[model samples]
Target: MWNIMKYVCAEGIVYRGLCGHRYADKRRSVRLWVGGPFTHQIHAVHNSVPFSQTHVVTSPPWRVLFFGTDSFAEESLKHLFASSCCRQKAGSAVVKLLEVVTLPKDLPVRRFALQNQLRVHDWPNVNVQDRFDVGVVVSFGCLLREDLICQFPYGILNIHPSLLPRWRGPAPVFHTVLHGDSVSGVTVMQIRPKRFDVGPILNQCIYPVPENATAEELGETLATMGAKLLIDTLQNLPECVANRREQPSNGVTSAPKISTSMSWIVWEEHTCDQIDRLFRAIGSRIPLRTLWMGEPIKLLDFVGKFHTSLSGAEAETPGTVRYDRESDSLLVSCKDGRVAFRAVMLKKRLSALDFYNGYLHPFFLKKLPRQQKKCVFGSYKTKESDTPLGREAAHKVQNV
Candidate 1:
């Protein structure tokens, strides 16, 4: 839905269109028309003022320039394009003109703009001559300079996936899940030059994080919510700008980008819950890693904590691996509890059954009788100074 504010004359003359249509009478009262997807006719009335001698006035549609790159940014661009199309069909569009700015690569937003036949401008190479009413940036990566920001009448608006003053960086969604935040949300804020996610907030909405939600799931939810919120913000752009407030100083935090080094799992140092959270946060992009028999292995299909018992489980220390025939899983002990995985990968991926038959069964048969410690998984040494022992070097391990 979109709103068009109009000034009403004392003679009850209504300004019929969005493009500054005016009557000769003096301005006295205002009428706000709430419009549907394809219709501009008034469906509801709000903030009605008493009519007197008033000149009729109207706000023109906006010329928007949007900047984006990833799937998260594509959602907002789609909404803006749809709204522009709807308004155009109704003879008065909320967005008068819409163009896109993206990197040269075939990113999500760039592909979308090309498919829709929207004018596309490559980043740092924009050639727009006419001034735009407003600019929008979402997951664009680059820090916009002050000279570029001065091109828009209303500056730029950003649709961020996290509430400002918290997780204020590129990997907010990842950190939110990694840190096990129970609540998360989206923020629509004005953009500032030479920095990121530090502008005054125009709008914000809270969304409750579902239990055991992965970063991908949380990101998908926030993307849709942010898109809808972006449209709503544009609908009330003037009022939003007038009423915008600076973000609170308190509760500030930073969310740095995810790194490959974070994927390594240290069985002796991390709890079951910590490892589970790490998998949910970044396992989709980077598999959870561990060292097996001094060789790197990737853990897959994480099945959370294991509850069933093995006959000699209590005797085995953390990083000791056991195959559960009943569940067809590989169970590894952590600092607090055990976690299960359905498959593991060294050179090629293998199911738990295959790994046990090919690698573990023979080794365990040879080592279990003698109660040798070499059969257990060990932490990979990431630094030159790190010791080869699993427990001693666990804290210093990095991605293998």
Candidate 2:
């Protein structure tokens, strides 16, 4: 008797259901359960055996637990529910067909953290002595204890957003984008009771990061790839579980958690390549904040290309504002070269053109008191200035 269960915690409520197997032709997913309204609907359509009706000699064939935060977890549950449609659709429908679960604006990160605990590892009386088939962890921020890991005879598989053996810590995407890695991909590792992303790589999906990929952009892309990778790895779990491997104790790089201080644009210490990576890594989602001319300016969008235009004596000082105007790009100098920026954010407002225009005057004259060259494309300033440059920049935006 196999009863596949899907568990999810949302809005202080817990949703659990039996997984359905009819979705796949391979029968690899003996049963797939998704914990949400959409999953419930899919269960109905797929005719999944009701948990009450089954008289099983043994436990369910497979039970998958999705450990995620409020919106992140709930949305993933909806995605699992929607995965039934993936077999029928061509190309990667996995990316486009996710069910959006919106959370309130005031939702605290603390509450979100609690929700994940309740949904994934908070099974009241579950005994680890009785082993389960497999456990797949995707984007769930907490560490799994040995008790939970032992319960899954098949072992726990985690979808980390970096190539294993590298960036094996909390913030892989940020490090990858900030450091400018030509290749970025996901690694499915066997989870062990350890500090952070230290585990044996069982499977992996590799991809390249574009020159202009930002952290937010790369994160979303990696998240989607992670979802698919989880499914693929889970389908092959029987084999992956059979061959257990431990992570190499040596040659491990730590990707420590991020802080606001770490994210602030440090124009002086970074290099041209580092700044280029930062511009791409910060992406549109998480606007990279920097103190520009004593006022905080959040970069909304930007472009980096080889520059031959500004090659003179001023190249000695990188991060110097070489050109700032209504033009689509603002050029800045670096130790070796320069880069141009376009999209930007002023205060909390997100607009590329407005941000450029607002800082154009001060940037041109190097009148920004707080401005200091950290690298080619980075300058620091705090958010306190009466300069009408922001207002004028806001008013001067011509096209989107």
Candidate 3:
């Protein structure tokens, strides 16, 4: 007489035995039956089951709520929107629903969300009753409270433009360029309440900073790179969350928001490279400023270091100014080297040629002896000396 028995394996496979004796499979994934000495036959019937007949497990699509404000954030939103549309069409959606939350002011993310017809929720007043699987924050300025963060199943993921523990504030890209860092990258992390960018890292990709890359150029590159990374993180959300690690405490740094006072050119303290980096970092938003004959002048169109034709006298004085006719740029001597600018603005904007003829020429011709006939910048000081001029200056600066 034969006795029949069944056993289930960890891989969800079932095994049946005629002799009631269990044997381990070679791979250890399942158990097989071995006939006893008195048994007539032994069989392994379910070993070659077709994949179509077996049950397959798959992760469901995610419902995502995104928070963003600027152009940098816009890139990630675009990628997520595209990915959702493509996946839905393929009938295996990665993101089932997408929505955005932004501040009241007109921002890039808000504009893109409106233009694309995606749902937009005004920030601090967002409704979380729709039951989102995850939340994404990119360049979003508002702080999320603990109660709000608990609404999402996967918590919130932030696409920070810098490697964390370093540059933990509102201006990572600007600080990266300003400090002349050789390498920078984007990081995907889980957001924690009451802090910014102090979250566990999910993924990171290093990018070598291009030669003399301006903050604007670097920002654009990182923005695109970050968008792709964000999608990749979402694709394997569970795995990323499982393997996430905390940021190290050794390299902690802060990237404070750029201010107008940071644009001042102190000839005695800064070098050509330092000034060049400064201009690349924030010159587009706030022109480099300096005092000329007790009046404010804004430097524009930085043309980099003047490598050739340096006189001993000009090199001796840090604030000495000279016009390079060959390059058609106004060269200003810094602590160790000379930097060139294509234009300046005092009462009005003027080209290098116009500035040389109007302000520099008359000053050199009349102010000092021929041996000391040099036009200098930052020679005078006022309480608001470092401030940039004009009504169109940044609101932050204007208020200050």
Instruction: Tell me the TM-score of each prediction against the true structure.
Output: 0.80, 0.58, 0.79
- The lDDT, on a scale of 0 to 1, for candidate 2 is 0.52
Rank the candidate models, highest TM-score first: 1, 3, 2
Per-residue accuracy of model 2 over 1-400 as CA lDDT, tens digit each: 1123432222222222222222222111233242221232233233233333222112222445444443323433544544434433654332222211122233332254344332323423234433335556665566777656655544566778888878887688888877778898988777767556676666778999987777777787877777677666655654543343556666567777665445455545565677677656544445555545445555555666545554473535555554445456656555556556665556456344554455554454375444342323334423324222354332332111
For model 2, where is the 10-residue window of minimal lDDT?
A: 94-103
lDDT of 3 by residue, 232-321 (tens): 988898667656777888999999999877887878789888998999999989999876654667898889988885658454677778
The 0-to-1 C-alpha lDDT of every candidate, in the order given, reads 0.77, 0.52, 0.77
Cα displacement (Å) at residue 9, model 2: 39
User: What clash count does candidate 2 reach?
Assistant: 24
Question: Which number leads on TM-score?
Answer: 1
CA lDDT of 385 in candidate 1?
Answer: 55
List all candidate RMSDs to the true structure: 8.6, 13.7, 12.3
Kindly report which residue stretches of model 1 are placed more than 4 angstroms away from their true locations once superposed: 1-60, 86-92, 311-315, 362-373, 381-400
Of the candidates numbered 1 and 3, which has the greater lDDT value? Answer: 1
